[model samples]
Structures are given as C-alpha cells and as structure tokens.
Target: MNIKFVCFSLIVMLFHGSIIAQELITPEKAVSLALDNNYGIKLAKTDVEIAKNNADILNSGYLPTLTGNAGANYNLDDTEVGFADGTNRVLNGAESSRYNASVDLNYTIFDGLGRSYNYKQFKETKQLTELEARETIENTIVQLFTIYYKVAELVENKDAVSQTLNISKERLLRSQYQFEYGQSNKLASLNAEVDINNDSISLMNTTQELNNAKRDLNFVLGNTIPEDFNISTEVDFNNLYDKNELLNKVKDNNISVLQINKSIDINTLGVKSESSAYLPTVGLTGSYGWNKSNNNAASFAAYSVNTGLSAGLSFSWDLFDGGSTITNVRNAKINLESQNILKEQLLVSVVRDFNNAWDDYQNKLSVYRLQEHNIKTAQNNFDRTQEQFKLGQVNSIEFRQAQLNLLSAELSRNQAKYLAKLAEFQLLQLSGEILNVEY
Candidate 1:
C-alpha cells in the first residue's frame, strides 16, 4: 500500500498540463521544505557551521603549543682555541660550523588577567552567532508563510473565474439553441455571446495574475516554475479557533523571541568576560636546547662541546597599557543593558503583532461567512429568475443579472476564504507553531 501511494504521488507530481492540479500542502510541510531547500535557509545553516568552527578554534587555546628550532652556522675565521691540561692551542685560520636544535613549549604562565576574559568573550561571540542564525531563520519563515498564502489565494481566484466562464458558455449555448427554434430574439443570442467573451477575457487576466504569484512564490522557495504543481482547496476557514491560547504560546515558542533571549544570555556573559580583564591570570612554560661546535685545521687545533640546557617560568603584567580595560568594561556593561532593553521591546512587539493579526483574521472570517450566506441567496434568486425567463415572464436582461449575481458571490467567497486562511497561517507563524504542526 505504501509503495502504491508512492507511485501514485509520483504520477500526480508529473501530471501537470491543461487540467487544474491540486496538491495538498500544510504550513508545516511548506516550512520544512523551504528550510531544507531555500537558499536563505541554507545560508543561515552555513552561518551556524561557521560559528561552531570559530568556537572550536577559541577552545583550542587551553592546549599547550610546541615549537621546534634548528640552525647551522659557519664562522669563516678560525675562531676557536682550547686548553686541555695547561697550555692554550691556537685554532684554525680555516672555517668551522656549529649546529643546534631544540624544542620550546609555551603554556601561558601568567598575565594581567587577559586570556581568561578574552576566552570568555570568544565563547560569548560564538553563542551570539548561533542566536543570529536562529533569528535569520525566524525572519525567513515569515517571508515564506506570506508567499505561500499568496500563491494559494491566486490559485483559488483562478478556479473561481474558470467556474464563471463555464456558466457564461452554458448561457451562450442555450441562447443559440433558442434562436434556431425562433423562441428568442437574435439580440438575446448576441448578448449571450458578449457575456461569454467578457468572461473569457477576465479568466485570461486572472490566469496571468496566478502565474505571477506562482513565480514570486518559487523565487523565495529557491525553486523554478514547478511543472504540474497546484495547491489543494481543502483548507477550512470556518474553524473559529481562539487566538488567546496561540498568543500564550508565542511567549516561549516564537523563534524570534527565543533568539532575542539567547542574545541577552550572550550579553550577560559579555559583561562577565570584560570584568575579568581586571584580574590576574597564571600558567606555566619551558624550553630546552643543545649546541656544539667543531674546529678543523688550517692553523687550528680546537673542538667545541655541548653548551648545556636551561628552563624557567614566565609572567606578564599590564601595569598600565592604555586604560583599555576600564573602557572595555564600561562598553560591555552598556551593551548588556542595551540587549536587555531590546528583549523588552521585542516582547511588546510580539503582543502587538498578534493583536493586529487577530483583528484582521476575525474581519476576514466575517466576510467569508457573509459571502457563504450570499451564495445561497444568489443561487435561489437565479433559480427563480431562470424559471421566469423560461415562462417568458422576464426578459434575458433580468435573467443575466441574476446569474451574474451568483457568479459574483462565488468569486467573492473564494477571495474571502483564502484571505481568512492567510490570516490564520500568519497568526500561527507568529506563535511559532508552524514547526509543531504534525499533519
């Protein structure tokens, strides 16, 4: 059964042509697809990876560094003389070379509390990068949600126009049949054709609009025009769910809010990192070396041996190095405070955004419901007028008006339905439930 479904899906995916396509897409699935495939999301992920690598580099400072050295030298002069028992012997007038090798180890003995604080700063910076990436994704999700709904809206409008065009064609056919039997005037036949032509032009214009909307949606999804892909008209706008619970969810769920909170954490750490700059730091370091020289004769008699090795502890003090420490500390504190203020601002903004979205959603819902009611009334009126026209109690003009009323109601209802759905999706997006949607 699963295999059959997969095969069926593939067939539908490839079956884009003259007929209308209707593929089901939920907000969550749309977002997931975009995050995986969208150019901006991929770039944001790259940013995250870059931050992780930087963190690794900063953490490596805690490890010891080993350095090796080797050198060879030629003293063109016979520069060596030696005495073994009692007498001094003259060395060569010829040249001799000395060679030496050693390895040095540095492990940060002590400093005026610079490395520790600097390390803390590195950690905070890395964390800040991560938060920035999350923030980017949140913004991208908003854009994606907007474009997705717009495409859905355009598609629904196109369907509505097509339905109206079909009705116009039926009217034209009936008028022609009547004219042939001498039951209707030639003018009625001409008027019916005019209606059909007008509807045809309107449908064409709507198709162009639908294409433009699709192109824009594809651009943001990092996709080209997909062959044969269409959206389902199954969304239920009549579900009058509450906005209060969703608003509550935004406090902890919204990615932007969480990202800002993460920034606050980074800033808090930044203050600590900077204040530690005033304290002293300590560690250990050492090095070893061996040296030798050889004397060869022209007028020489000398030899050289090992010089021996030495090692010691090292310390650094910033007794006064430009007063940057105080300035940096002050700067860090200010930044920390700024981040806190930013958090408060974002919190307020989230609430306002939700309220605005809720108001718009409710209005759209009302319009959709009213359109639904209008559709029934329009259909009933059209039926009565059609019966009157058949009995010759009303002319074609009155019958056409009643039919147009029904068409207008349907078109208006489609617009209202999709607009309401868009508002609902936006509300969910603000609440961060797009990620949690299961089906």
Candidate 2:
C-alpha cells in the first residue's frame, strides 16, 4: 500500500509539474494581460459601449415613428328592420364583412432643445465611462508592478537565507572536524549544528513567503497561479519627480478628477434638459387608410368602399406640473455643484497621496542605501571573523553573531527595495500614468 501511494504521489507531481512549467512574464506583459482580462475592466469597457450606444442621435427621440394597422371582421345573423313608412321587413341568414388597413406616422418637430442637451449629456457620460475604465486599469497596473517587485524582494530574501544556511552548514562541518581533532570543544560542535537547523527553518519560511508573493501576483494578472516562476530582479529607483511637477501632472491627468469634471458637465446638461420642459412641444401626425363593408339582406342588400388621407399638426405645452420641472432643474444645479465640490476634494486628495508616495519612496530608498552599506560592512566583518575562526583567533560565538548581522542586513535591504518600488508605483497611480509603465 505504501509503495502504491508513493507511486500515485509521484505521478500527481509529474502531472502538475508538466502543466505548470514556469510561466515567465515581465511586469509589462502582466499589466497588459490584466487589462485585457480583469473582471472590473471588462465591465467598465461594457459600460463605455453602452454609453456610446446611448449617445446615438437616433436614440435621442429625433426620428418619426411609423406603424401599420390592418384588420378584418365577418359575421352572420338574422335581422328585422322597421322603416319610417311603418312597414316591417325581415331577413334570414344576413351576412356582413368589413376590411380596413392604415398607415400612421408621428414626428416630434420640437422639444425645446431637450434632445440636443440629452445628446450632449450622453457624450459626456461616455467620456466618463472611459475615464472610469482608465482608473480601473491604472489600479491594476500599479498592483502588478508593486507585486512583481514584492516577489523580487521575497526571492532576494530567500536567496540570502539560503546563503546563510550554507554558511551555517560549513561552520557545522568545520566544528565537527575540529572536535574530532580535539581543536574545538564538543559544545561548539553541538551549537553549530543547532544554528544550521535554525537557518534551514528560516530558509523554508522565506521560500514560503516568495511563493505567496507569486500567487498574489498571479491573482492580479487574472491568471492561474503556477508552482514556480522567475521575475526580473532589476527595480528602477531613479524615477524621481518634484512634488510641484507631480501635482501639475495630477491636475491634468488624474482619472478620478477628470471623471468628476465630466460629471459636472453631464449634470449641467441635466438642468438644461429639465428646463426645456417648460417650453411647448410640437409634433406632426399623418395617416392614410382604406375601408370596405358588405351586407346581404333580401331587399336591403348593400356594399360600399371608402378611402381617405389625413394629416395634422399637434402641440403640447406643459404650462405646469405642480412645480416638478423647477424642482428638477434646481436639484440638477445642486448636484452639479456637488460634483464640483467633489472634484476639488479629489484634487486635494490626489496631491496629498502623490506627495506622500514620493516622500515614502525617498525614505525607503534611503533605508535601502543604509542597509546596502550595512550589508557590505557586515560581509567584510563576517569574512574577517571566518578567517579568524579558522586560525583559532575568534570563537564560534563571534562568528555566529557576524553571520546573523549579515543576514539581518540583507533581509532589511530587500524589504526596503520592494517598499520603495511600491511607493514608486503608487506615485504613478496617483498621476494616472501607471498603465504607461514599461518593464
């Protein structure tokens, strides 16, 4: 049973391994794939299409409506008739039939420019859809870049841990050899072995972290998570901008702010549309028809056919509707004002975010620089200590401390690098330029 289970597991592993051959993707490709498949972006695109459909002038109630009508009826009955001459006539199995057909047309000639305002409103609304979709795509792009860097960070830490583990393993082997040669005490050999085990555990944890980061990246890309993959290790840290310059860009390009600006225009049009209700509406109506009737009644049988054409102009003035039109216009004005207020708020928010992101990136970059320097110093110190340990000048305790310091510096440097990268992406997102990011 054990052998069978082992074989089954091996087969399963092979299948998954074959299917999940490392999917290498650059950050640019990740963003492109996400923009194409992300559910929110897809829905936003559909909203834009719907707005475009609604913007068609033909859908703005500008065209005439035409309809065709036709009908026929037949009946049979006994009938009795009394004429004014005081004579009565009776007929059996009386038959009658009627046939009619008509074509009708109605056209609205005027509506106080309401249709024009509505058309303009739809156009603005369509632009709003585009801006909203841009916002979604930008958000996803920011996430892609940040998470890609995060994976790089975790992988860096994992490599550092593995390196530390290898150092510990070498120290353990040296300790064992020294103890066998009676150069190091047995206690030193046991301590070295314990450190090796601890470093191995740390390596395992860092590997798990890297895997989680990759999974998160896959989620953002709207793709299946693979067992393993490699991302570019290079992170750009030189994309710096002055706060004033960034604010200028944000004002012109922020998607949320642009959407609010467009909303104000749409709401202004809404007021105009409502105000148009106070004026009169004019329409043209026309119809042509043919009708025929036939009857059979022993002495009063009759047959007739009639045809006619009719056309007329119709007008309606909604002089009053209990003040609803005025109320609607006032409400629209208030909403328009609200949109302007929101736009101001968004501008302030975007500026604040941009500055904070820029500052955070700079701060993390500083930390990264410090950690980088610290790692160099620690590496030098560890190398000197290792040589001393080999020559019996430094104890194993001092060498272990040096190794720990180097590992800590390495991990902190990796963390700072990724954090700075995240801040950079956030700045781009606020500027509405994340989607333009390349590798």
Candidate 3:
C-alpha cells in the first residue's frame, strides 16, 4: 500500500514535469509579444510619436527665415527726352520695363519671452503624451497577467476534474466486485455508479470551461489556440512584502500621478505664453540685391541697372484686448486647480486599491495552503476506507463519502490555487510592481 502511494506521487511528479516542459512561453515573452502586436498599445505609442513631432515643430521659430522676390513693370516708349540743351540728348532708358529682385531675411531678436514660454509648454505637453502612453501600456500589462492567470486556473480545474473521475471509476469497480460476490448491498453499488456518472458530467463541464478560457486567452494574445499549451500551475503566493516600498515606488512610477502634476505646469506656461502676446516684440529684417530692366517695344531701347542694401528693426504689440487676456489667465488658474484636485483623488484611490489587493493576496495564499493539506489527508482516508471495504469491514456509504471528500478536496485545491495567483498579480499591479518589472 505504501509502495502504491509512492508510485502515485511519482506519477504526479512526472505529469507536472511534462506540463512544465510543454510550457513554451514566459511572462516576459508574453508581455513583449503583446506590446509589439497589441492594437491598442501600438496605436497609443503612435500618438505619442505624433505629439513628439508636434513639439519638434516649435524649434523652427529659433531659426532665421530666408526668401526671394522678383517683379517687372513696362511702359510704351523711351524717346530720348533730357534736360534743355542745344544738343540732342540721348538716354537708353525710358518707361519700357523695370525689374527688381531681392533676397531677404527675418529673425526674431526678442518676443517678450513668448518663444521661451511657448517652448516650455510644448516640452510639458510632450512629457504628458509620453506619460499617457505609459499609462496605456501599464493597463495592457495588467490585463495580460490577469488573463494568463485565469486560463491557467481553468486548466488546473480541468485536471482536478479528471483526477476526480478516475477515483470515482476505481471506487465503482471495487463496489461492483463486492456486490457480485454477494458481499455488498445493491444500494451501495448503485450509489457508487451514480457518483461515477456525476463525476463524468462534471468532467465534461470542466473541459468546456477550459476550452473557453483558452480561447479567451488566445484572443488577447493575438495568437491561434495551441490546443495543448502548458500553463504554469504554481506561483509563490505567500511572500510578505513591504507596503511602504510600494508607496514610495508609486510616486516615482505612477504615470497618472506624474501626468496630472505636469498638466498644471503646462497650464501655467500657457498663461504666461498668452500674456506675452500683449507685450511689445522686437525683430530684425534685412535685404540686399541687384535690379535690371527689359522692354520689348519699338523706340523703347532701355538700359537700367541698380543695386542696394538695407536693414532695420521691427516691433509689434497687441495694445489691448477687451479683457481676453484676463479671462485666459483666470481660466488657466482654474485648470491648474482642477488638476491638483485630480491628483489628490488619484492618490487616495491608489492607496485603497493597494491595501485591498494586499489583503486578498494574503487570504488566498492561506486558503491555498489549507486546500493542499486537505487533499493529502483526504486521499489517505479514501484509500484506507477502500481497503476496509474490501475486507468487508466497512459499509458502502462510508467509502462513497470518502470519495466525495477527495473530490471536494481536489476541486477546492484548484480554486484556491487560482485565486492566489490572481491575488498576487493584482497586488503586483496595485503596487506598481507590474510596471517596474522588465519585460
């Protein structure tokens, strides 16, 4: 009997090893695959890049602008008309056509610090966009772990159902032998058969559930169902961790928190930038080029050539705007206040979430250990009762109850294990550990 238990334990170990071997994916691989292929996350990243490009456009203001121009005018004729002299004065130029061309440049010398403030706003906006992307990525990350654990849990439950069916079949075989030999009652044998039938039905239900879970996981992973992909069945679920560490980490890592705070900075900069529009701005303009004239007309032979250069300063001011600037400044302040309130609310919610996740993890871990121990004890009791029944020392009802105990123990074990896994992942999420973990 002891040898049988050892053999059974060895079989379990071998099965576990095979399952582990069939597992081809790691948490890191799954996350990397999902990030690269997931539609929502990929699109979010693209939006961040677009925002970054927008920020790059602001740099153009720092560079001087260069341009060129050309034009010409024409008149009817250029009869040599000159000062009153006794001599026939001739001038090769008349109102035939005039041409002008120039290369010009303009550069901002100052703008009441508008450029500086606007540049700052763009930078802040860029930072916010990046944070938004990260927040989206974090959401996807939590989803990946959550779905992975759910699928794993269902698979575990299916395995438990299989084991339960096997035990029920074995009990039925034992009861049939006893009844045929006139050593057991018919009702007991009937009950044994009924238990086997019920277990079979449960196995079918469990298999269906496992299939549904697999399909759901495959959908999220952007992959075809593998039909036999192995799932890791165990994770350390009872390790005590410091809540203080998590609190400290959230400040440095929470994208939502960082983004809302930076939004106030953006609003403040916006008000400053808008205010600068009312102040006087200084700039420089310069041009230098040559001019030529051409005419296509009879008696209009024209010759003209000119060259010049000039440079000067320019200024601009809005003067007044019927309190528009004042309204803008007030709105910016209001927005800043709203952002501060948002940050405060987020912090409170995150703290509560962490505490809840931590407690759930602890409770699930405890239940899992209890279920593990229960399975061992129940298995032993079932085996002993079957032996006594074979010896004609126990009744069929006691043996059937033993079988039920074992079945319940196995199911509870699977449920507890899965619950613990979910709790651990949730804890990781609430504490920002999921985001910090390298994929």
- Model 1, 1-439: lDDT tens per residue? 9999999988876775334454455666666677778787788788778767766754737677889999988876744555567766565566777889888887865554445555665666677676676666667776775677667777776777787778778777888888899998899889888888888898898888777776776777678336446665566654555678888988887777877777777677667766666666665666688787876674344766675556666555556658898898899889888888988999899999989988998898889999989999999998898888878899878987887788788778877887887777678778887555542
- CA lDDT scores, all candidates in order: 0.74, 0.84, 0.77
Model 3 worst lDDT window (10 residues) = 295-304
Residue-by-residue lDDT tens digits, candidate 3, 1-439 = 9999999999999998888666565667678767777777878889888888767854737778989998877776545544456555454444467789999999998887888888878878888988888778778877876777777777777777787778777777777787898867787768878888888898898888777776666666667336567656556644567878877766656666677788889988877887776788899999998888765433345476889999999988778778897788788778878888888899888778777877888888889999999999999998899799778788767877887788788878877887787677667766667766543
TM-score of each: 0.81, 0.89, 0.79
- Regions more than 4 Å wrong, model 1: 1-29, 57-60, 75-93, 109-128, 237-244, 295-310
Ranking, lDDT, top scorer first? 2, 3, 1
lDDT of 2 by residue, 1-439 (tens): 9999999999999998875687777766676778777777788889888988988877778889999999999988798988889998887888899999999999989999998898898888888888887887777677677778888888788888899989988888888888899987899989998998899888888888888888888777676445577777777766657777777878888788788888888998999999999999999999999999897774354977889999999999988899999899999889988988898888888888878888887888898888889889989999899899889998888999999998988888888878877877777778777666565
For all predictions, the C-alpha RMSD in Å is 6.0, 5.3, 6.4
User: Which run of 10 residues does model 1 get worst, by summed lDDT?
Assistant: 16-25
State the displacement of the C-alpha of residue 204, model 1, in Å, after optimal TM-score superposition.
1.4
Clashing residue pairs in candidate 3 are: none
